[model samples]
Target: MITMQYRIVLPADYDMAIIRKRIAERGHLTDDFPRLAFKAYLYADRTAAYAKDRENLYAPFYLWRDTEGMNAFLGGAGFAGVIDSFGRPVVNTWSVWHAQVATDLSIATYATREIAPIAHHIALGELRDTEHARVQEDVERGALAAVTAFDPTHWTLLRFRLWRNVVEVADKNIDVYQVGHISQPSAKHDS
Candidate 1:
């Protein structure tokens, strides 16, 4: 599977309600979209979380069934609509490793996103092992309801999570998407 996302940094004074409304109205347009795995429409207010100097961001995360699915979405109307509203977004993708979501996704009302540079000299096995362990630990702590870890290229690594409550961690803070409104892969299996 493939994971994709891009962010739009809103001007500091820009009203976020506009973006929130956009998500409310059009975020789920891809619900049953062809080859879609899942899409999470996310928003973050820099003043609310993260370094005070950060800008508000609207970022949507996706897990595609395959490249066909990824290509279709990017070239499809949904993406076009996004560009019309937010301008062109720099799309990023990752090879997914483990994705776990609890049955009640709606409860995932909070989220955290962390992007960090990859350590080029690190052994692949070590990196994978460390990431797997960290994700598992987050789940065990009840801090995360859904999590997806990626083997990143454009970025060293990206970690995103749907959370049950406020996590003390300083990662990017995001508004949780409503359940049923979000979409996920139809079938699940080990990768």
Candidate 2:
């Protein structure tokens, strides 16, 4: 599977209601999209007390069944619409090692993402195993969904999770976003 995200940082004075309305209107277009696992429509409000900094943005995260699905979405009008609205964005993708979502994912209203560098000399097998285990532990601790993946180009590991409430992480680099909606074609899965 693959994980993808594109973050579009808006102006400090940008109104987030525009993003919320867009999601309310168009987020469901991909509800039954082929080969899609889920799409987390996420955004951050700079004015919110929970915000790490004063930077408003609309960043959507996606989990695809394969490259074919990823390519199809990128080439489709849905992506074109994004380009028209926000201009082109630097889309980031990672090869997923693990992904799992609870049966009742609708209650997930918040999401978190952490990106950490992978050591060049580290044992990849061991690293993958360790990250996979961590994801399992997070699920057991009440995460509604979790994904562990890595980008070979950047040698960075990405840990993403969905939750029912806002969660604070000790890692200062972690990004927290409010989930506007979730588009899950498969609906439920574990892997």
Candidate 3:
């Protein structure tokens, strides 16, 4: 599967209610969309934890079954609607490994992006296995509702988590989360 993210960082004083309303009104429009695995409508307030140095952001993450699905959305009216509402967005893509979802994710209130900088000397297999293990750990123990890992291959070792709250282990880490509410699918999906 292909993973995609488009982030729009808003000004310091930008009203976040606009974003909330947008998510509420249109977050599920992509449900059952062709070749779409899922979309997480994520946001972090300017004052949220780990957001001290960042602007309020609307960063929606997507998992597409293939590139065709991604292209369809990006090259269609859906993308045009986004541009009209929030200006041009820079899209980022990554080759994903395993994206595991543990039952319903609608209960999530926070999502975390945990990254480890991978050096050129490290084997890709080693890094992949490590992230896979981490996902299994939380998913098996019911600590996380969903987890996805991917590699962009030149920057950072990346993984994402959808949780009901900030896990205590992440309290001291540089973790980002959806400040108030999360817009995830309510139905359970096969992992």
Candidate 4:
């Protein structure tokens, strides 16, 4: 299976509350048609405390699956990029993992690759104007935890991509897979 990851920086003037509401209301009915695995709007503990106690106000981590269809259902809704309480542009990082080996090592490796591009992309992009922070470290930690904590045997990491816009898929990198990893059992073996 193939999955795409996107990280975007929301406009400073954007409204997060409305955005969350829109997401919940819209659900997975987007143009892309990708299945909604999970979605969260991340924030620091201090910020989270101040946030309105709403179920829609999630963290910065979200997962989507393409099992229902090949395309993601992100019709016209734009990605809810990072925005501060005051609606200022904040650096956002995201990664896509294509389950490759199904083994522990494979999952970990894909996770690392998934989050790595965010730092690189931000550094190469507008983030250069910002101060030096531990964004990379935080993303790395999150990616590590995601892969290590989740256990799946019948998965493989295939293609990884980082994007900002729903229309344009940017910075795509496809991972190599081993041969015969997904072969079907032979009928003769059933006897």
Q: Which ten residues in a row have the lowest lDDT in candidate 1?
A: 171-180
Rank candidates, TM-score, best first. Answer: 2, 3, 1, 4
lDDT by residue (tens digit), candidate 1, 35-70: 876677777776664334577778788877789989
Whose lDDT is greatest here? 2
TM-score of each: 0.82, 0.95, 0.83, 0.28
Q: Candidate 4: lDDT of 20?
A: 52
How far off is residue 85 in model 1, in Å? 1.6
Model 3 scores worst on lDDT over the 10 consecutive residues at 182-191
Name the candidate that leads on TM-score. 2
lDDT values, one for every candidate: 0.68, 0.91, 0.71, 0.28
Worst 10 residues of 4 by lDDT: 175-184
lDDT of 3 by residue, 1-191 (tens): 88888888888898888988988888767765677766778887877555665668898887777899999999988789999988888887777777786456667777776656678797878878877887788777564544455555655665777777665443444457573433333342343
Residue 79's lDDT in candidate 2: 99
Residue pairs of candidate 2 with colliding backbone atoms: none
Clash totals in order: 4, 0, 0, 27
